[model samples]
Target: MAAVDQNSLRKLVEGQLLRLEGNAFQDCMDRLGLVLYPGDYQPVRAAGPKGDTKNDGYCPKARVFFAAHATRGETFAKTKGKIRGDLEGCLQEHRDVKVWRFLTNDTLPGEVDQFIDNTLRPLYPDVTIEVWGLKTLADEISKLKQGQVERIIDVITVDEPEFEVVVLNHMKTGRDLWPVLSNCLGWLPHEEPHDCTDDEQDLIDSAVQSFRDWSDISGDIEFSRFSVRDAQRSITAILEELAEKRLGLYAATTDDYPLTGGPSPFLGTVAIFRIVRVASE
Candidate 1:
């Protein structure tokens, strides 16, 4: 076997680190439901306080700060020092801001971790710092992929707010598995019910049954795998049927409202469904 060239190894590591940082940044933003404005620069830059002056008036309302490094030892130290200096400057400029740091690298030295906890954290209490080595990013990516599965479910249930609501409610009711399911669903586990009543339970049950029936029908009519669009259509069809029967489950008024209007509850249900499917899978 031939030994790998040092230049080639460096290039490969750099490329991988760049890609991973981009992905990690995107994942963090998506998890927080943030609409990321385009950034012109890479997450990590070369070490120095020279360009630090440019950030004098650059107060960003970013909840998180991410830095990626491709090398270890002294190189890591120099890069971290520059980033810390820059961020500290930013924090000093903006008094009431909090920033979380995510550091991505193949390995982290013990002394560096200690420095982060003991030195940097104490100095900047407003900045919450988290370090992710290669293994951590790998694990996070796996979890994100699982979340994507439920996101597909959300897309399918878009048209069926009633069904989505019932599914979310059922997820809340199931004691043992509910927490795990709720994480997948992107909903915080609530100890108290969110205004679900006995009558609402009956409506929810019917809606869930309608979804299952539609899933069965979809399996027979088209492909084996159930698509979210099909799920949405099925939910919509069921809601329309219930409305025709004067069930009074949905609002009677057809007037357009804001995104946070009467129909917004149903929209939230769909959002929760997507979150659950992504997290669970």
Candidate 2:
């Protein structure tokens, strides 16, 4: 068998990631108790794409102005500048925007972290700026079960199950199907993501993805809730660990290394963490 092109596979994966990022972004916000009104990207327009008036979205629950940028091939530093520009534009144009929710396909880099902290937070002191980057996207994908991944693979990869049914029918009729089946099954020619025509792929992808995204109205709601809770826990863990170290450092502000340094009552609190880590190791 010929080796599949890694670059094509990557492009395919990135395409899917970007397309799904919006819903996943909404899911994360929902988990944080912010409910975005279902709508389009551009502001309240008379007619939305495909005759749908609701293409963009707004979060009344958080009073946020949401922006989705599924940038495929950009460094985080470049993306950060773009985001800063967009957020500045939003603030300049929309007086009602209380929170700036920026979602991107690129992972957040240290430059972006500094931008958010030293730039965004300080400059936009009156408004809240939240970013959902590639790591967040990965975490959302991680919550998808092995089963979910397989189900999607089954839907998009090939017509194996259909061919299996054909084999079963042949067996029932007691036909000599060895040569015929052998050639057909050989290499198990599969549908790569790029193989499907756009329309056909969209139909299959949407049906299968919808099955995963929305099993039923209730199941769909449950799936979103599960995603939200899972993401919240992941974010909380990172934030809490940072807060712990910062708290320790604050307690021993004068110490050379408050987190691992000269005596302070919070030192024992820090010590306990070290002991736990060593024990686990």
Alpha-carbon RMSD to native, per candidate:
18.8, 24.9
Structural similarity to truth (TM-score) of each candidate: 0.32, 0.36
Q: Using TM-score as the measure, which candidate wins?
A: 2
Tens-digit lDDT track of model 2 for 167-223: 111111102211222111011222223344575445444432322222112222334
Candidate 1 local lDDT, 1-281, one digit each (tens): 01212222222223233443444534432332222223321233224755433132111545345443343434657756855765565565445545544445456667667877888888877667667665454344334332332231121212211221233332222222222221221122122224546764566567544433443333234442345444555556655544443332211111111112122221111112211111221
The candidate maximizing lDDT is 2
Indicate the residue-level lDDT of 50 in model 2: 32
Off by over 4 Å in 1: 1-62, 72-76, 93-95, 146-281
